[model samples]
Target chain A: MENFTPGASFLGGVLIGLSASLLLLCNGKIAGISGILGGLLRPVRDDTLWRVFFIAGLLAGGAILRLVSPQVFDIALTRSGEVFLLAGLLVGFGARLGSGCTSGHGVCGISRLSPRSLLATLIFMTAGIVTVYIVNTFFGGAL
Target chain B: MSTLVTSFLAGMLFAVGLGLSGMTQPAKVVGFLDLTGRWDPSLACVMLGAIAVHAPAYRLIRRRSAPIFAAAFAIPTRRDFDLRLVGGAALFGIGWGLGGFCPGPAITSLPSGHTAVLLFVPAMVAGMYLHTLVEGLQVRRSGIVHPETVSRSPTLPPSPALQYRHDA
Candidate 1:
């Protein structure tokens, strides 16, 4: 496709894998973004610092990306504020309820061959695909 | 000190990967999900590359008695396939497709200071808080302490069993 960049995606994926590996090896953490963030909302003693640092690091990383490759942050599609709000609510609730998101279940869990993560990944991916189909078909492909 | 620093570095590396992989771009994510449309398989490649490195690396790392910085590996150990897991995932997928922003990318995109990310992240956090509230009520009514609540209290050390229940 016109937008596909397999090489960059692959290299990025390697970095993600390495990041997850490092976190697991050093901190014994799973690098699941939602889980990390959720833990912050209801923090425990001796557990809050790493999550804070990790999240801060994420924000810093974003800043670094902005400086290094401004083009990658480009927004192609514009959705209404209502759409974003609704989607955010759903994502937040569901990720916590489900206990993981893409990184935890899709990458780390699947890599560990965890059945729960595998199932969660499949369900979420399928749901996402179905949602896109519905939006394209009924909502005129724009939300 | 080392723990926080390492966590920050790992988070930075993860964000870089997310950006380099084009994950921060909602359109690209939507394209990957839009199989019927002119699809972009870049997301698939990202997953493949990530799994290729992490799977074996995970196996190797787990061989150690303990992680370098922590006393024990805090990995999820639950095996039951329940409705909460399935239903939550489905709801999350719907949100993901509608917005093209999952938790990671949404946070990573925050530094860009985009209006969309600003709107999305706060709402996501609110939703998470709502879940906590609802779960708290449920636990209260049931007269049972949720593992999540227990694990977060200072009175108890983080046991592998408790961590397993909520570590996802």
Candidate 2:
């Protein structure tokens, strides 16, 4: 925990935003993680290849990073893998119900000045804040 | 070859960013939010870093009428903040607090061979299908289904009927 540095985080965010922006510039997509994964379920033959490659590249990046700088990748999931998985599902549910995720609404959506994105981003951030408060205070950090 | 390729590469870069920032791991996310103990600020850094990098690019995108890949720009025109927004946010919060992973990190983590992702991804997909199912049922019950189906394009302006917007 003490080892966490703002520099690395900032660099990572920059990369995320840049990647998102470039995707928008080139693919004209929102870089919404949910939408990308959702596409996998009913993939068009023409669209299937790119999505697979995109996802594969994501995994490869992590593996490569782990290989290059194991220290940088030291953070591990503290919760039982099951809990994290359930949490992931809920987030997905929420993102769909709300029509986008943080990347869509929080990043690209807001940047685009879409009113829906603004509202969605607000919900996303608030949910994150409340979740932290409840988990740390009410639950006594049980999770 | 054009937009898809560009976006695919961009998506890869985004994945790399998550990998580099330690976001792909749920523990760090949970630890940062732990507040009571570890209280990690890595998420903040991720947000800040993303904002800084996109500032310039955003300006350029704004100048364009529409993106290159699609026929027109992708923008949601609704202005009201309504029940759907509030309710969804509440649901999102509970889930995030209970589980450290958000949709982006959760999906990205899937290829990493994490067992949690195995559980989460399916649950997430099921949830999505359920929403669509419920909506389909509602439309059928009304006997006004065909017109509704015709109006369901992402590019179409968001209709309040499809989503309750508060700004109205």
Off by over 4 Å in 1: B146-165
Q: Residue B134 lDDT in model 2?
A: 59
Per-candidate DockQ values are: 0.85, 0.48
Tell how far residue B6 is off in model 2, in angstroms.
1.7
lDDT of 1 by residue, B137-163 (tens): 876786666566665686966543354
| Clashing pairs for predicted structure model 2, backbone only | A26-B3, A27-B3, A77-B27, B32-B40, B80-B166, B80-B167, B81-B166, B81-B167, B82-B166
TM-score of each: 0.95, 0.80
Q: After superposition, how far is residue B111 of candidate 2 from its true place, in Å?
A: 3.1
Candidate with maximal TM-score? 1
Interface RMSD of each: 1.0, 3.6
Chain B TM-score list for all models? 0.90, 0.79
